[model samples]
Target: MQQSITPQHEHEHHESMKVFGFWIFLMTDCILFACLFATFAVLRTHTDSPFTGNELFEIPGFTAETFILLTSSFTSGLATLAMNKGKVKPLIGWLAVTVLLGAAFIGLEINEFMKMVSEGATISTNAFLSSFYTLVSTHGLHVSVGIVWMIAIMIQLKKHGIQSVTKRKVQVMSLYWHFLDVVWIFLFTVVYLMGVM
Candidate 1:
C-alpha cells in the first residue's frame, strides 16, 4: 500500500518552493543589473562626455561606503544566526544595526549624488553621467527596499518571536542582504576603481 503524505512534510515542501521562487526572482534581478552594467560599459567611453571619471569620483567617500555595507552584511549574518539559535533579543539588536548601517550607506550615497549634481554632473549632462547615475541609483533603490523589508521583519520578530514563518523570513532577508553586498563589491571594482584608474 502507498503511504499518504504528512502535513509537516507538505509544509516543508511549500517553504522550499518559496525559497526557490525567491532565487528565481534574484536571477531576474541579476539580468536587470547586467543590462545596466552593459549600458554603462558602452556609454562609459563616449567621446563627448563632459566629466572624466577621476574628476567626479571621490575615492575616500566610496571607501567608507564600502566598509559600512560590508559591516552591515556581517551584522545581517549574525541576525540570521540569532534566529537559528532562537534568541529574539540579540536577533533584534543585530537587525537594528544592519538597518542603521544601511541607512548610513543611503545617506552617504545621496550626499555624493547631490554634490555631483551641484557641480554640474547631472544625469542630463551627458550619456556617461546618465548611465552612471542610473546604475548607482538603481542599486540605491534596491537597498532602500531592503531596509523597509527589514523593518517589517523586525516588527514581526517582536510580535511573533522566532516561529517557523519568522525564521524563514529572516533567512530570506539574510540571503538578500548578502546578495546586495556581493553586487556592491562588483560595483566598487568596476565603477569606482576603474573610474579612478
Candidate 2:
C-alpha cells in the first residue's frame, strides 16, 4: 500500500519546490544579462565618436562605486546570518546598511551618466554610447528594484519577527543582492578595465 505524506513532510516538499523554482528564475535572469553583455561587446567598437569609454570613465569614481557595492554585498550576507540566528534587530540593521550602499551605487551611476551627457557623449551620439548606457543602466535599474525589495522585506521582518516565511524571503533577497554584485564584477571587468586598457 502507498503511504500518504504527513503535513510537515508535504510542507517541506513545497518549500523545496519553491526554492528550485526560484533558482530557475535566476538562471533565466542570467541568460538575459548574458545577452546584454554580448550585445554591448559587439557595439562597443562601432562608435568613432570623439568620446570613448577610456576618456569618459572616471577611474577613481568607478573604483569607489565598486568598493561600495562589494561592501554592501558583505553587509547583505551579514543580514542573512542575522536572520539565521533569529535576531531581527541585527538583521534590520545590516539590511539598512545594504540599502544605503545600494542607493549610493545608483547615485554614482546616475552621476556618471549625467557627466557623460554633459560632455556630449549621449546614447544617441553613437552605437558605443548607446550599448554602454543600455547595459549599465539596466544593471542600475535592477539594483534600484533590489533596494526597494529590501525595504519591503525589512518591513515584513519588523511586523512578523523571524518566522519561517520571513526567513525564506530574506534568503531570496540575499541571493538577488549577491547576483547583482556578481554581474557588476563582470561589467567592471569588461566595460571598465578593458576600456581603460
* Model 2 lDDT, full chain set: 0.91
Give the distance in Å from residue 151's predicted Cα in candidate 1 to where it truly belongs.
0.3
In the range 44-96, model 2's lDDT, one tens digit per residue, is 88877467787888899889899999999999999999888889999999999
Clashes of each: 0, 0
RMSD of candidates 1 onward, in order: 2.1, 2.3
Give the C-alpha miss distance for residue 188 in model 2, angstroms: 0.3
Model 1 ranges with Cα > 4 A deviation? 1-5, 47-50
TM-score of each: 0.95, 0.95
Q: In TM-score terms, which candidate is top?
A: 1
Residues 60-107 of candidate 1: C-alpha lDDT, one tens digit per residue = 999999999999999999999888888999999999999999999999
Candidate 2 wrong stretches, greater than 4 Å: 1-5
Quote the lDDT for 186 in model 1.
86
